[model samples]
Target chain A: MIQNVTLVGAGNVAWHLGAALEDAGLVVDVVYSRNYSNAKALAERLYDAVPTDSLDFSESKSELFILMVSDNVVQQVAEEMTLPSSGAIVVHTSGAVPLEALANAGLYVGVFYPLQTFSKGKKVDFSKISICIDSKSERILDMLAEMAYKLSKKVYHLNSEERRKLHVAAVFACNFTNHMMTIAQEVMESNGMHFEMLEPLVRETVDKAFAIGPDKSQTGPAIRGDSKTIGKHLEELDGKARYQEIYKLVSESIAGIEKE
Target chain B: MIQNVTLVGAGNVAWHLGAALEDAGLVVDVVYSRNYSNAKALAERLYDAVPTDSLDFSESKSELFILMVSDNVVQQVAEEMTLPSSGAIVVHTSGAVPLEALANAGLYVGVFYPLQTFSKGKKVDFSKISICIDSKSERILDMLAEMAYKLSKKVYHLNSEERRKLHVAAVFACNFTNHMMTIAQEVMESNGMHFEMLEPLVRETVDKAFAIGPDKSQTGPAIRGDSKTIGKHLEELDGKARYQEIYKLVSESIAGIEKE
Candidate 1:
């Protein structure tokens, strides 16, 4: 059981994870951040968890420490923290960084990555999020697995390499998809059309991808090699050079998929 | 009132439109298609609607004729169908085709494009989808608008030029987004990871794009010029050479956005 937990960040992931842990009946022992106010705000919602701005190595006192800081800060934060005991486990919620970074501290370290992008001021459904866990020791891995299973139905014992691969996949799926949507919104708005018009299609595309997976569910003019429609779309570009290029590139890519 | 409607072809669009219209208390008087079973199945969904397989010009007989056939078949469907009445309104549900194709038949012609990607066996929330309407006559346009408003909250009186532009935008927002998701799924499954793991991130990326728009919300290794991680990711790519190239291209594009 994850009885007491310490959260070492106050970003979107930290806020949601802190609240989720508390809701799961775990005691969030303390919340720490360089920005004391951010720590306090998250702590206030975490069932009496104490909030502090202190980075003192002397304060490492929880059974589980969750580092929810940015990817760039994960290593520095890990280096500065002092564990209360070698028995305590330190984990960072980052997709990139190796598990070995925690080894030099001579503590039981692992990763507790929530495979989700969190936004501030929005509630997260942890049940839908996958938790990727990896630890230096079997005993620590077991404890992390137990905690992850409590929060999510899907849990994976991924090493640094696998996690890094997954992160790259996430870039393609999440980041690229969002950019595509943004381009679509820009195109619609430029035509005096409302962006909301694409909302149903957007929602459906995601739902369908989840339902049948993406391979079989894919359909469009590009996949069909309907060059007439593609040509018309390109002509409709009317001097918007970059967007037209994107349209051509993506369509050609989809066409290539069809060829295979 | 769009009391009497004639469906000129039995297909995905026709089936959906007939059902929605019947549910909204309109009369689908006749459905004509080369495939009798399809026409019959659609007509059966409507109250007392007749299904006809006639291609003869003498059989024309309805207030509104909707040709919901394929893009290539639409023009042919329109050319063969004689208007039941000289003043009867004719419309087609196509994003790319001009409303003018429904002309030359000596009837009031227009377009009634429900701006959504339709799939058989999938139930859609029509109320949220936008309907694009255009007619040769203002009275016909008003009637189309009212019918559209009955089914949805959004109704746009887009001319052929504007509707063509919207179609091009749809290719980006709907079609291209789907392709990106397909690639993401491919990358994950080709690895040891399950496609389900990427769902949360996919949903969040979309939510964030809408919240801040893509241009400002973009954040990835590429945008940050974190070439170290990018190189690591490239090294991690197992056998998906196409995906790696896509990753490189998109990353460069994101870097360009950051520079701008």
Candidate 2:
């Protein structure tokens, strides 16, 4: 049962997680960021959270310290931070980084990776988000799981490798899907069509994909093996080599999946 | 003020469109399908629609004839169908086939394309769908627009070429996005992870993509040019050459997009 917490980094994930934690009756003791103003802004939103640029935690007695910084800086920040040897659990909110990245931080380390995309000004409902947690000790895992359950109903005890694989899957699902949408928007905008016209279709595609597994719900010229339509689409994207390449590759992949 | 209509074909599109037309108070006078049972099943759901296997519309007196057949057979059906020469408007509900495909139908021809992904047994709300209409004559366009407005608030007067372009974009936005989701699901399933864990992320990805244009909202290792993480992901997809290829190409494309 973690009662008090300290947040490191004041970016999108940190801001949202900090707010959710505070709302769940946890006291946020401090928020540390290289950009002091960012830390100050985020800290202002929580109860009795002091914003500071310092890495020293000797003066505070928070039960948990969460490193919510970027992937490149997590290990560095973890190495530099000084925490109590035995009492507080240190965790980083990253899907890509392994628990070993914080192993040398001289504290009981764990991962509290929330598997969801965060936007700065948007308020996220944590209940719908999956929180992936892993720790070296059973006691620490239980404590982290309890804390995670307070914020999210969907909590998983994923190890480092599983969490990393999940992150890769997320890249394909969320990141690649968004890129496909960008290509669609470009195609519409180039032809003097409004992007909003594709919104309903977009929503239906996602809904159908989830309802009946994406493989089974696959449609269009590619899966139909209609080379004529594929040719026409390629012709439509003649000058844009990048777009053509992506279309050809993905379409062929879909065709391959269908063949299997 | 188009009211009485006859539908040709009884697939997913025909099923949904026929229901929406009937619910909007339009008389579906007849339905024709090569598969008599399909036509009969659909026609039974509508108001006073007679099911027939014959292409001949000589016995029917509907004001409008809508060809809701597949793209390969749209022209063939149009060339064979017999309709009232002067008053009845002949149209096809196709995004890929042009207005010219209906030119030889020997009537006032037009397009009544509803830009949406239709699945069998799924009842879609017509109000949110966009209906794209086009015709050679002002009178026919006005009548089609009026009928379309009955089913959808979002109606666009796109010409054949523009509609075809929109269809291509739909392939990317809807079909390709769904394929990316398929890959994600495959990754998760292979790793013994439940697909539902990805649902919220998928929803948020679409929401963010729409809120801020997908190109601007794009995030991930690829856009960030984090070569180390990209390398790790590529290595992770080792044996699956197809997945590896797609991941590399899309990541490179995203990196390229970021450069520009």
- Pairs that clash in candidate 1: B60-B84, B61-B84
Candidate 1 C-alpha lDDT tens digits along A168-243: 8888787777777767777788878777777777887788788877666666678767788888888988686766
All candidates: TM-score: 0.89, 0.96
- In the range A130-155, model 2's lDDT, one tens digit per residue, is 99999989999999999999998999
DockQ of each: 0.56, 0.80
Which CAPRI tier for candidate 2?
medium
Among these predictions, the greatest lDDT belongs to: 2
A-chain TM-score per prediction? 0.92, 0.97
Question: What interface RMSD does each of the candidate structures achieve?
Answer: 1.9, 1.0
* Model 1 clash tally, residue pairs: 2
Docking class of 1: medium
Stretch of 10 with least lDDT, candidate 2 chain B: B80-89
What's the CA error at residue A5 for candidate 1, in Å? 3.0
